[model samples]
Target: MTELLDQVDWQGKLYSNGWRDASGGVLDSTEPATGAVLGQVGQADAADVAAATARAAEAQPSWAEQTGPARAALIRRAAAILSDNRAEFERWLVREGGAVPGKAAFEVELVLGELWEAAALPTQPWGHLLPTSEPGRESIARRVPLGVVGVISPWNFPQILSVRAIAPALALGNAVVLKPDAQTAISGGALVARLFEAAGLPDGLLHVLPGDAEPGAALAADPSVAMIAFTGSTAVGREVGAVAGRTLKRVSLELGGNNALIVLDDADLEVASSAGAWGAFLHQGQVCMTAGRHIVLESIADEYLERLAKRAANLPVGDPHTEQVALGPLINERQLANVDRIVTETVAAGAEIRAGGNYERLFYQPTVLAGVTTTMPAFREEIFGPVAPVVVVRDEAEAVRVANDTEYGLVAAIQTGSVDRGLDLARGLRTGIVHVNDQTLNNDAYAPFGGTGASGNGSRFGSQSSWDEFTQWQWVTSRKEAHGFPF
Candidate 1:
């Protein structure tokens, strides 16, 4: 793992144009579970962002002019390099991002899929023809790259979020300036730089800056950047969107979610319990699609709660790098404190902690909360932790009402014996993504992934959605003879 760091030159240097020292100095990337210093990461400031964006602006045109097959070959090479270093990347994810081994492996798999999907973008048909009303005229509409794209990614699932934007933007002939969260800079930003560098990507086409909010804000407001792809909390996303909106730059925001998993009366308790546990507890419930609210039918609420509590109580929590645990530590102390506060306050507001409401250091026990109401913080807010708040509803109508009550409309799930009933309830719930007879934690590289309302703008990231997110339509017309103007 240390060798991987050395290979990538992860010793206090940013990848702006090329590997160089950042003016803002270096910060230590530490393991959250044990507070061990993994390596030093260069911190980029406003000036670095400007320099990177300017360089990206200069490089984009020629890169765009490259033959589609030529650009695609490089993207495929990057994916190959990522595959070769899969084990090292997984270790880094476990250490820097505090992800469990399984979660780390899953993230890597998703990233590889994203890379492969992006590689196909260059060769896809990007334009269409339309009939013209006038004689000797031809009209066409084509999708063109948005020049330079600025990517701001979060620590949770850092690599996937960053690559989902970066891979597509680069493959679609747009240069990128990426600002990864300081906490998981290596896994998110620097490592990406190394992969592209190893794959023989052109210098100045991609820049990796690992830093605090200053560089991120500068990147968002940079005039040379044509678009901003942001993924984080709703609060931060709003700020980024506002800044980008002022400049009239396109922005893609994949923000927070207070998602739900509905378990109907006919749901198989055993199967639903397993799915619910995985949905809420995977990655210590740090996912945006985490099933924070479990709305159950009143008839089987008791049995469902019992089953959920048992699963929460038995799941192991510890350092993922050294232990065989089901759940890993939260990203840092701030996240852990936030999770604890929500759980404590919700309990005080009359919710019952049915099982496992405790923590030592950053490893929080998977908690099951019963008798939770919509007014409680755990039920209303996006609790990014392994805490499941179960709410009882009289019927499917009440379940849909409770699910749609929140400001977030990111994702939802319905578990029932009848697929038709589950699908019917899914239609009534107001969310961008829904899973019938499944849990809320779902994503695919070949499928559109995003949310509505506070969760995000209407932008999505994946498959054909990537084409829409990274490019804009330009209409072109040609004629054998020029038409006279109606003066």
Candidate 2:
């Protein structure tokens, strides 16, 4: 087992031997599952943000000039380093993010895969020749990277989300100033820095300045940052988008979700129930794309809820690092309280509590609720925890209506016997990623990942979609002589 360090050792520093305090001292993180102090992270404030931005600005010009293949090589090396240190990386995620060991390992592997995919972006074919009017006229379009990107990643999938944004930004030859969530600041920030260093990347190409919204907002508003990449709640995302928009800086946001799963009357009860429980409860239901608001056919609503409750109860809740533990604590005390309040309020509003709603210590046992309506807060809001509320729908039409009744359009799932019905249901749902007869939470590198409406503004993942997100295009035209004839 890897031993937790009391404090992070700053691998690189300014000209002055002593670390500067533009960001003040440090922020402490505790492992919620065990109530143990994970470690302290160096915090960055407004001054630190400025310094990091300055470094990124200095590094951007030369980096942009380098051929795409050159940057790809560094990213490939970084992927190799990540593969070599998978165990240590997994341990850090489990400690810092309360991720179960298996899920942590899987997420770290996904991050590695994303890094590998991002490397190919450098040398990948881009641009095309376009036809133009007149004999001597010619036109072409080519893609270019945004200079320095300000990335604010969330705590849910700290390792994967941060790496996803950073890998692509770096591969495109852009300098990055990353602001990881305060909860995972120390471990997440330090580990990401190490990966870049191990890959032998340029000194200032990637910098981690872990801080709160102040520095993050400042980064978004900074003139030096050409783009802002953010992943968090819709409320915060909107603020970041507003700031970035004001500055005319390009931005990509993956935000809040009150996603739903529709189970048709003809669906397989066992499979659908199992998928629903896992989708709603995994990562303690902290995923922005979780299917928390379940829309079930009235005919099978009772049966589905019962099976889901049993499956959720079977999941062991204990130390995150234990192999037997399928689920773990909420990220912190605040998250637990928030989840409890939402569930309690829903019950007070006449919703049936199907399973666990009690929180022993910090763990909120996987909760299931029936008799939920779209009007209830738990059903409408993004209660990002281990709570699944099953809302009975009279028919497929009602399911569609209820699923699309939210401000969020992130992801949705539908389980149906008929392919035609499933396709029709998927088309009707307002979500970006739609799953038929299965769970909606799987991460596919080849496919686009993102949301719509308040869920998010753009797509991400190790896909062609991700490539398009961080780039802008320019058109070029040439003519031997003036094309237009004038009288």
Candidate 3:
């Protein structure tokens, strides 16, 4: 067991009846890299969902009753604890999620920063002082937590993705019923309970019910939950959104992406090549916002593609635990197969493999496919793997068109020597986040981050923006005397 998990207060209290289903069936949590039984993780069914929601609904009012300042204080304390134990948390992230150690540390550190930023929401919720009709009549708008928030996070960045959204929800004085991605249920659930206790969060304020779609859908469909926040595929996001919609509850979705990277004619060859490689291959390209499609202007398309192909081929691939590893394995065999299918299909469709398309023990070599057209399935879909498909474009206008051709608008990046040109191209891209001279996955704690179109419905881990997602604004007004109302 890792040091972080060993410190857990799991005296059969925080997690009980380990790895059992709602019907009391045991399921093993499989390690993605090796397909070994990591441990048993509890699986919640509809009944478990109901129970968790009931608990959350019951605790909601008292939690909401706490002043925002009080909640903020608790969040600040949590931030402190995260900073104090960053190493342990990062290690746990690597062991459980198969993230490269450096990337894991970066995400954990970002989570702590997010905690502190969310803590400041109490004193700085950007509500409005509405204009009043008459003098001596005062009107103001105040934001309040959406009681009983349902947070469903993905496994990609388990600790950061799960906690970042939950922190803001709790800091804004809401009770949370979280269902992390089943693959990372144990780590995510354990961290949530432990961090809350370490940070002094009120008992029963946060609950983790790890399970499958049955439980999650039930939770979202429940009328008791005021809001639902989810991070996953667009297909599932639509299903969850429909359920939440029917109940008239607030919903925030961070879905999948087939993000694009545009390398303009004026772009520095070296910089663009490096950025493109990282954007496409980082996280083994498992990130929703990974730049799967590389759009290079025709002027230097050949040279750019050649340089990127070399860089992709050279990235060190090995076990995540090894310090020499620059790229780790895909999350599971399913992901490996998914990438494999795309690679094989692209090749069959006449696209040439420029660098790599081989796999060994879950580790996939960084691949770059040349002469890929928009009609190819790899170009049309979210290839969440270490595969970069290069498409040549005539000019900036064509680059823009090709980048926006996809159904996914989660994130997009443009590289150009001219800042003005980059900004101009960026403004035209439909992605939720557009970057100039950098990749869209460049994370900042305070920025409103998420996606658009099929990519996502709203933001997360974005300081006050996340608070807004988890909170509701109420209009509070006082008058000198009761005014006569005409009904």
Candidate 4:
């Protein structure tokens, strides 16, 4: 892993008209596992941002005028390039993002799939013809690309999260100014720029500015930017949304979630427990859609907790490079401390530590906490760690009630023997996604992916809807026959 990191010049720099050096001071990008400094990432200041945005504005019109199929062809090239570099990307994710092999694999696959999906976007229908009132008049509604889209992507699943917006935005003819999170700046954002460049993308179309929140805030508030697509915590999303709102810039936010993974009384304890452990602990429960709150029916709660505890206790927590390690460390010490704090407070609030909740350095144990209540911090807040708080409910009705009792409406799942009952319960659960006899961690590139309330705001990914976030639908009409109005 160290050899691979050394082989690649990990020095993060601004990518505008091709890769260029940033003028601002440099930040040290360190490995979370060992706290070893990997390399220095050049920071971008306001001047750099202005130059990139100006270039993006200049480049967007020509890109937008190109035929849809022509644009699609370029996206196809990028997808192929991403697929070819899968091994390198996986290693980068492991080192910089702390992704386990399994997590890294999924991230690569998802990125590739979404790129392919974006490749097909330009050829899709932009809008529709509308019925006209007058004869010889044609009315059409067509979606046109926004001029420049400012994409503020989070560190988690950097490749997928960043590409999720970038691919579709570029395919639809909108130029992008990307601001990647500081933690995964080089591993995530810089690699994305490399893929586009290698695939023959025009310079200045996709700019990656690597830094902290200062740059992010500037991007959000830039007057020249046409739209904003952000994926991160709800708190930051709100601030971004506020900045966008002040200017009425087109914005799409995929924010936080506290999803519920419920086990019905009739669920197979064996299958459900395994599914529960994976849903709650995979990637160290760092996913926004992770099932942080496990709502179990009273009849099966004890057995489910017992099985889940055993599995959690055995889950390997160490360096991702090692084969023995199933789970990797948190992205950095800050995240590790936050996760530790939430778990500690939850335990203090009367939650029982049934299994694992220990941590050494950045590594956190896959934890299962029983006797957790709704009022507890672990149950109330988004743990964003490998901690699962099991909440036992009396019946399905109470389970549904407890599931819907959160500010988030991201996702929910019910594991049960009866398909009909599962379907019925799924409908009643208020969430953007509800699964039957499955876990809440499922995601497919072709499906619409988003949430309601705090989870997101009208930016549904996957399928054709991904284009909707980056384009505007305008009603246009033309009169073929010239008509003169007489007094």
Candidate 5:
């Protein structure tokens, strides 16, 4: 047990200005794979959340006042520290978040890439100059930090999701107080705080308040926080957005998805099937951008579904810590029950279960369902599990129509032969990210990543988009000659 979960600092406590116990008491962090007791983590309440945010607020101005290059250097140093501690971070993911080795390593590298991405942001142009109409007057619109940001992250891909926003917020000169999900307190929250602190970041510049929704709500509603970056389900995001709206605070949400990988008639069945299998089963399909729906043309439906099922079954499924498992256990028993419910409903509704559907404790087998209808829960909602639902469409037009039928507009993928046709269909996708020949599970650090409609707010991350989300615009005008104005 020690060998499996070694290198994790699970002396669970709220890490604010420094380590402290939660006034609200403690919650046990368990390994979903083995149900082993990981540690007792401190659970912060509203007041604890307030204290963390207050400390961040106090440190923001000074951090923001630092030179842009200086800030970039610090961010780069943090990235270096993460790279140095890669093994420990990977262990934390497997022990705390139940991530398989491959998935755990992928997420760790992903967050590191995002940190390096933000390291360059301090030098990017955050504003532009416009042509002024008045004589001797210059107009410049510049983006400034929003002071302090509150980050609420979910259990799946916790570190990747939280730091995706946190790195950019810090690059833009905003201090952050992150409230990671109770399940990912150590991996997502404390790990981040540790890295930045090791990299010589000032105390109170970033705070990790590991707790439940009570602290999350308090952070979102806190007057000191200027913005809230939340990554979770649409239901919870709606509540977070409502609170942020009431407070008139800036909010960026990366919510749920019912994404599709549309395989047109001209698509290569083998290639398309592999892409679909990987996308749907990676990280147990907990990823928001995973292609849960396979909208394949009727011409290739049988072949694609058969191949996907075969690949899914062959994927190594075992103890994530001991074996080379591709699909790990769900985060906890709650997720196990949720996935079981959806698969059961879909099967009962005339959908054929083509592959694995059994569950052992928190470990759920990767499942594939065919003949799925749009109204089915498996097709309509975000499954957040390693379950693929196949929906056959008549043609390319119907494929597009069926894919766009959902309220989610997070990610859409198209696999087609003609480059022109692929480009055309990509343009018609209502989602934020569209993959022409690839899977929907593409999250490159250099790209502009986000979603539309219920999937997320219009806000984006990565490149220039990240800076835009954490900053406020200010217009400035300077005149060399004083002009007299008549009142």
Candidate 6:
């Protein structure tokens, strides 16, 4: 076992009924920054998924029978356990997920917030009484768990995304079967199992099966699994949604984004540039809400571009574990190549590179591209790298038009001196999330988080949304005596 796994007894193994070896075998977990083998993780296949889901189904009824306060107490213990091991988990995030120190710290904080928020879920109201028309009759509508919830999380922001679903589902009395991305299995899956296990959660209530697509597909298609919460690319989300749809299982899809940051003529270029840089370059732009498009007014385009380009050029990119840098390497060479292809093709299509347009291994520089149009790939597609493409719009209408042209409706931001103008423009933008006089990167554990159109299927996660996502409704009616019916 590696030192990172010392906090928990289980190391690089699947947790179904208990920590055990996987039939599919183990794979090396490598660090993207150095290609070093961090550890070996057990991989789960279709059969493994079957066993886990069966166990979860069998365990869920008893968990749901527990009192609400009892479930809340267990969830609170998990939060405390996470708080105790905060620093250690942050280090694992840096090594396993390629997160910079600051990003790792922020992710840990977000996960903590999620745990805290989820801890309160079980004690909340789960049902309401309904008015009855018949004399001496009573009616009630109650919220109930959806049996086993299968969570399929991506490599980027694995811990935060996975727990946002896992914590709440379990707290709401549903057993969970989590299948984290293979590259981030330990941090996303095993670590979560350990926390809940140490918190005294019963065995079979939670199962962590880290594997590739085969297990994920099986998890979604399994009849025993009533719901699935998936966070990943739009392409994969569609497939998951389709499979879940076939079984008529409830699914929440939080997919990709090509968000925009709009700068108005009356905006402060300094503040706007800082927000834009942070929105586009945070976590090396691997976020689903990354501001890929920068739509600025033509009057202030030159000055805004200068400020953005300067910020981009000065951002340090390297192994975040060894250096204080603004950005880290892309997840792997495949992502790096995709980023390179987008930048190279955009530049070839008449877009001018303002600052950076290159990479060394997986370390891609924070790039700024000017002279970009909506027809170009950089403006139209979601470039999941630290590249900011600026598009000059003649007016506010044109900016809104350009921003809303894409298939994604995830998030958008408007920067302006007047709050009224920013708010008004935000109304015109067609996205699930909008920020006025700010940037596109934002999340709150107590607020509803999701997207529309290609970004998702209009499902949300967090806060009261969790109740709707993880549970179903049931209505019960009763009478004091048997009523006579017409013969």
Best prediction by lDDT: 1
Residues 311-421, candidate 4: write the lDDT tens digits: 998888898876568898898778888999998999899999988889888889999999999999998899899999999999989999999989888999889999999
lDDT string for model 2 (47-122, tens) is 8878888888888889888998899898899888778778888887887788888778889888988888888888
Query: Which sections of candidate 5 miss by over 4 Å?
Result: 1-10, 136-138, 480-484
Error of 3 at 195 (Å): 1.0
Model 6, C-alpha of 453: deviation from truth (Å) = 0.7
Tell me model 1's lDDT, rounded to 2 decimals: 0.93
Candidates' C-alpha lDDT:
0.93, 0.82, 0.81, 0.87, 0.87, 0.92
lDDT of 6 at 270: 98
lDDT comparison, 2 vs 5, better candidate: 5
Off by over 4 Å in 2: 1-8, 11-22, 134-138, 459-462, 478-487
What value of lDDT does candidate 3 attain over all alpha carbons? 0.81
As for candidate 1, its clashing pairs are: none
TM-score of each: 0.98, 0.93, 0.94, 0.96, 0.95, 0.98
Q: What lDDT is reached at residue 313 by model 4?
A: 87
Error of 2 at 126 (Å): 2.1
Model 3, which residues run further than 4 Å from truth? Answer: 1-4, 8-26, 125-127, 134-137, 458-461, 483-487
Q: Who is ahead in TM-score, 2 or 6?
A: 6
Model 1: what TM-score?
Answer: 0.98
Candidate 6's TM-score reads: 0.98
Writing each residue's lDDT as its tens digit, candidate 1 over 1-487 gives 3443566555899998778999899979999999999888899999999999999999999999998899899999999988988998898899999999999999999999999999999999999998889778999999899999999999999999999999999999999999999999999978888889989999999999999999999999999999999999999999999999989999999999999999999999999999999999999999999999999999999999999999999999999999999999999888989999999999999999999889999989999999999999999899999999999999999999999999998999989999999988888988899999888988899999999999999789887899999999999999988878979
* Residue 350 in model 6: lDDT: 99
Residue-pair clash count for candidate 5: 0
Q: Assess candidate 4 and give its lDDT.
A: 0.87
Error of 3 at 317 (Å): 1.4
Q: Write the per-residue lDDT of candidate 5 for residues 225-264, one digit (tens) a residue.
A: 9999999999999999999888899999989999999998
